[model samples]
Target chain A: MEKEQQKRAIEALLFLSEEPVKTDKVAAALSTTSVEAEKMIEELQEELSAQGRGLQIFEAAGGYQMGTRPDLSSFLEKAFSEEVSSNLSTAALEVLAIVAYKQPVTRIEIESIRGVRSQHVLDNLLKRKLIKISGRKEGPGRPLLYVTTADFLKYFGLKDLGELPELEVENEGAE
Target chain B: MVEQAEYKIKLPTFEGPFDLLFHLIKKAEVDIWQVSIADITEQYLAYLQSMKELNLEIASEFLVMAATLLRLKSKLLLPRSPKFQEQDEEEELFEINTAEELFQRLEEYRAFKKAALHLRQKEEEQKKVFLRSTGGQKIMVFTQQESVYTIWEGAHHLSEIMQRFAKIAAQREYVPAFSAVEDFVIARKADYIYAVLRQKRRSVPMKDFVIESSLWEVIITFIALLEMSRQRKVNLLQDRPFEPILVSLIEKQPELFQPEEGESGERTAKESY
Candidate 1:
């Protein structure tokens, strides 16, 4: 396929997909390798940026998805009459930060970090589908492990877990 | 007792002694920049005395705030040279700003609390309208009680089981203790789902997958399943009202189920690798 045609196809795939579309899947569909698909995607991203559209492509959860530009979210919210806004309570935001920094983490670990029971805050985040039960911890009582969902990545505009800013250890070797 | 009840009724939720001081400052409309510490301290102690009379629970937070106010008041009373007035002004201004910030936060919190009450009323009205509309349909709606923690707990249990099984498989001697019912599918995609379903069958719920495996194994299997899902080799389904999700093998993906006689050998090789 022509480069322009391939770019359109990738755009269509991302738009139609309910979940993040992996680069390899896009490559296989276009009969190209992942490296080629990635290059094409990079070119397409530049093209989209040059056009100055409200939508931008984002890499998240090891895949790509079409996301609303941060600057345009307020306009979109007004246009769609979106009732559910992402205004988190201070406690909920704190818990979310803890979970994001230390994921595949158990509730006990989170609570220990915050010095309080995080059950209510965890419940609220799960209801919003921003965080999910990724799995369980293996110990005396199997504690459920929590991880940020793709929605979380998309909402926060993060490429992947690797994109999280490296935590500055206050005192690494003091112990 | 009657007088104490009346007194308690007038006081808002006792946040702390700082909150009480802030409340008095706001009511007095005193410029925080020029706050008379002696007057504020006297009012704060009076409030504490009143709280004691009301028999309300007085936490250490309240007592600590009292001590802090007293210390600040004494600092303000200290005689200093005219040259040091600038330093004192800066320090006093900072103290006032801190108190002002706390007061603003409390005011914002109160506004939110009031808004929450209004929201509750709106929710009640909506619920009434919903019930009125649904009067004809005998639909049974069940609210799912499960939370993320519950789901995580289930996954945790499954990973533990997978870990135990992996350990047994590694020992070689303990491998015979496990039952072998289905033929091992060798194709990479088929093996991924088969391994998961096998683990699921043993645990009954997919949460068992997490319990049965080591952290590393659970993570690998999860990534493998995710990759397979991306490839459309398997289907993952979940229902509303929080039922345990069912992952089924999609038969259309024939490449996934293809068996290899050398599968066990390949598994051993993979383990070694």
Candidate 2:
């Protein structure tokens, strides 16, 4: 396929996907290698930006999705009031931060840090599709471990976990 | 209470004790090391008092923090001897360590709150952008017709199967021991219920209308109540579904539907009506 045609095809896949579109899935569909698909995606991102369209092609959760640029979000919020509004409580925010930072962590570990039971907050996060039960830890009781979803990264406007503010390691050690 | 009388200041909305502590620390703008323990402790206690006055249910975690602050404040008040024993030094060190740990936790929590604030800002920006639900489809209104049709079809098939099963079960020859008795029957159950309602002369819940007996008695009593409702002998006052049915005898008709009494008042059983 021509590069222009390939960009349109990749855009279709990302637009239709409710969740983030994986690189492998994109590569397989385009009949190209994963590296080529990634390069095409990066080029497409540049192309989308160059066009100065309201939408931006952003990568999140180890994949890519076409989302609105953060700057233009205000107009979109006015256009789609219900869908755009989201206000998380402090408890939920703290629990989400804990999950975002210390991912693949169990409920017990989160509780130990927060100094309180977080079962309710975890449930709220799961309902909102922010955090998900990644898998069960290998031990007694086999407690479910949680990790932040692509929605979480998108909501926080982060490209990935790396975008999270650098926590000072030296300050922790100073104690 | 004394703290409540000293400071009439009302704090802003705080998520938890750490958040309040962070606010106090920021408002004072003092270094943690130089921060006056006495002043902070008083302010913390006043906030707690205000929370109590508002009838807010404070969590135990907040109380734990308050206790720690009080301990630190009291340690600051005590005089230090020039000649310190090992145990005295260790105890003083422990108090200092506790205070330091509390400050460290507060600092860590503040960093996360700052990150949270950043995320909040990002969220506000992102809120202005809305993604299309489908492939470039600006509108996506979900319809329930398909799901509704399937549910009705499923219910219709389930009812048909149940009717067929009932016919098959009815035709079977198996009979239980209780089928032979005829005294405690459905027809007589209505009269018995009528007599009880007339005797009591008050509204009674359907479940209570039929005293605890066998499964057969419960079923008969339900049918009897339904029959009485049909005849207008009693009013089945049910305000809502899934709620108890209140059965009260209609006024001015004191005549009971008296049926033949069994020998032991424990009438012999009959097959279900």
Candidate 3:
């Protein structure tokens, strides 16, 4: 298909999908290679933001999602004025940061760092689906290893685990 | 010196020992590596005192940290004689260099705490974006703001759901006495009657099959006798209403197992009668 037609189709598919659309899906739909599809996505992203369109594409959780321009949230207040504030508590946030940075880490590691009993917070995070049991550690008692989920990325507005905010620490190689 | 500790600090909330310690270190306005152990320990104990005054129960982890701080304070205050300095404490806390290790821990916690703050700001920014949805038939944005909200909302009813499932599991243990009607098969009973008659070369009383005295088996045996009689493969005779019935083969049919009309499965007791 033509480049313009493919971009329009990609936009339509993204707009139609409730979940983030993968580049492979776009490739399959347009009968194009993944590389070409990704290029088109990038070009389309640039075009939308350059024109300051109402919709902007975000690369998140290993897929592309089209969302309203973050700057225009105030204008769209009428539609979603009653949106609940789902911010987590500081304690919960701290635990999540630990799990995010040291993923597949056990509860003991997080608790030792926080110098608190974090079992309740870990349970709450599990209940919230922010973190999940990745597997059991191969240590004594085989404690469950916790890792952040895709929903965690969306929750924190992170594109991927690599996008987690920088921690200015010199002992990166310690653990 | 412990009794001289003052209660000037008012901590709003401390998640745990490290949080309180971090706050004290921050209040002192000193770097983690440069923290004055003597001053911080005094302030920490004072806060614990305030927590007690407010009737706020200090967690055991806080007490452990408090104990650790005091031990470190004494180590710092003690004169560094070569013999005393070389021998590590009996507990060997933090591999003998408690002060340096504690600083490293504080530094790690501070990094994570800053990351948490960064995430919080990201959360605020993320909320404003409002991923564009098509007002999908009956889309309600309030419930879908965060994917985690749906999970928590679903979790809210989890107790009620698990309670219902537990009831179902308890009920599953009860085997309803007569409602379990699938075990007996008429065709299999008819085959047994055929085998008995063939072996005896004479009529076999139906009471032989109904020896168990179970109502289900007796009912099924009677039905099987009637069905065999209808097919003309056996003759069923009863002297009276309550008398035991006799079942006998009329003609020798070779291999009666396979249904002549290609009917595959044995009729369950619940199917016909």
Interface root-mean-square deviation (Å) of every model: 14.8, 4.2, 3.1
Cα deviation in Å at residue B212, candidate 3? Answer: 36
Q: Is 2 or 3 the stronger prediction by TM-score?
A: 3
TM-score of 2: 0.60
In order, how many clashes per candidate? 24, 5, 0
| DockQ of candidate 3 against the true complex | 0.45
| Candidate 2, position B131, lDDT | 60
Worst 10 residues of 3 chain B by lDDT: B140-149
**Per-prediction DockQ, in order?**
0.02, 0.28, 0.45
Question: TM-scores of all models?
Answer: 0.41, 0.60, 0.65
**Per-residue lDDT of candidate 1, residues A20-39 (tens digit):** 67889999999999999998
Q: How big is the positional error of residue B83 in model 1, measured in Å on the Cα after superposition?
A: 52
Q: Report the C-alpha displacement of residue A26, candidate 1, in angstroms.
A: 0.8
* Model 2 alpha-carbon miss at residue B236, Å: 36
Off by over 4 Å in 1: A134-138, A172-175, B1-273
lDDT of 2 by residue, A1-175 (tens): 9877987899888777756678999999999889989998898899889999877787766788788777786676677776645588877887787788878999987765555567999999999999999999999999999999988987765678998887542264365
**In CAPRI terms, where does candidate 3 land?**
acceptable
Candidate 1 chain B least-lDDT 10 residues? B127-136
**Error in Å for residue B95 of model 1:** 32
What does the lDDT read for residue B162 in candidate 3?
A: 65
Better of 2 and 3 by DockQ: 3
The local distance difference test score of each candidate is 0.58, 0.70, 0.78
